[model samples]
Target: MSDFSGIWIPLITPFADGAVDHAALRALVRRYADAGVAGLVALGTTGEPATLDAAEQDAVLATILDAAQADANAADAADATDAQRRPLPVLVGVSGNHTASMLARIEQLNSLPIAGVLIAAPYYTRPAQAGIVAHFSALADASAHPVVLYDIPQRTGVRLELDTLLTLAAHPRIQAIKDCAGSLDTTLALIRDGRLQVLAGNDLEVFSTVCAGGSGAIAASAHWRPERFVALYRALTEGKLDEGRRIFHALVPQIQLAFAEPNPAPMKALLAATGWVRNELRLPMTRASAALTERLAALGETLPR
Candidate 1:
């Protein structure tokens, strides 16, 4: 029932000494909220949710929800003076390789104060399109909150096809999609139909997708250049395409470095360089190279407000 039709940042997990840095994590969430993000997605790919254990996931979600509620209360108090102050919605990502495990995870998350769930298409198992539809349909019915489909074929190894996506859209509990299929044709098909709100999961495709009548993005790079991404979305909404393109071009380099290495490694390094979070990651995902870190730092310096 939530209208997820704007920019949401898939927040990165902050680490210090191979542990979840709760203080730093809270600060980062506050920063995203203050930066005017439409929503915050905790424990997504960028959050390195896969690296976290069950306890850590629960703790992180609690911290994020607590801070979000506080912020919402603050915004309500400040409504008389600053219309800009509003609490951003919190979205938790629940993705796994097994359908049953994912269902269990969704059940566990039902108690959280999250606005909705972002469920990635089952990875590695590569279930058929029909299986994918059935799995999501069951999840939508089970979830207490709305469900946002995550279709990043490059990472998940299985694409949620157009027909199946259309079918899934009709389900009342299914709200929107984090579309990372990286295909203009597929994006256009969804937009032309005007059924589901299409969020560009890939940063580079955001401008085109918005121009093509899609909703907005859930950008990884938005963690760093939050204002620029916000301005792009606002410009598009205001029908100022030329201004939006200028901001988009200015951000191309930063977006490139955000993914220059594998995901949160590069993003974490960038955040660390800016003193936002400590430059650390759990095992199996090490810090970025010295050169990449330096480049990200330089790119961070060039970003506009």
Candidate 2:
């Protein structure tokens, strides 16, 4: 199974003049790469994939991959002996409610060099447990890349039962889980079982999840202060509990404000204020409010430099 641990950032797709801002997106990828993030997830929910058409999605992903490669080469040139200078693994988020369509998407991804695919339960349909299992199993079977299950019931309107998860864990292709089910019992259970790598999908739960023997997180909030997130992950994994706790406490405010509104809005706002990307989101997903942006800016200033 691929090592899907540490603080991975689900990048927000930057926009300018109502188009995908490839330049800004590449810069954002380089920023996170330099911050020592474990990996990157392109076209995830945080990236506003829903708002982008197929061509735009493909372009955005290509830009991210290209930028990451460039960043890796630059780092290797600067420090050939540094093991961490190697290219960061990149994962593509593929989701859908249709089985056949989703299969085709997964098949297309099979040829890519991504670390894995992050898939969620079929939304809206809320299929039965058996159906859900079959859905993921077939998708995994079709996918050449490893699968990372996303278990967020709030958005999917269906919970992946513990038994269902255990069953999926048995599959060779299904290797890890992005746990956002909001059930501590299930989270701990998966951690205890130790079959699949459990990555905390919730930003706030990153601390608890790592402390409880789970792997790391795929936090959207880490987009702002990724180094601190990486530091916190290292602290926890290295038995520096006190240091990890302190960093998490300091980060709680920023994390809360990042998600104070729908994801990527406040994130985009802060990034915009800092001149990283334009503060624009496609219609139906507006920019973060002035008030929230102000709060986020203030909170961002408080983070360590």
Checking candidate 1 for backbone clashes, the offending pairs are none
Question: In model 2, which regions exceed 4 Å deviation?
Answer: 80-84
Per-residue CA lDDT of model 2 for 78-182, tens digit only, reads: 564332367778899998899999999988888877899999999999999999999999999999999999998898899999999999999999999999998
Query: Would you list the C-alpha lDDT of every candidate in the order shown?
Result: 0.85, 0.90
For candidate 1, what is the total of clashing residue pairs? Answer: 0
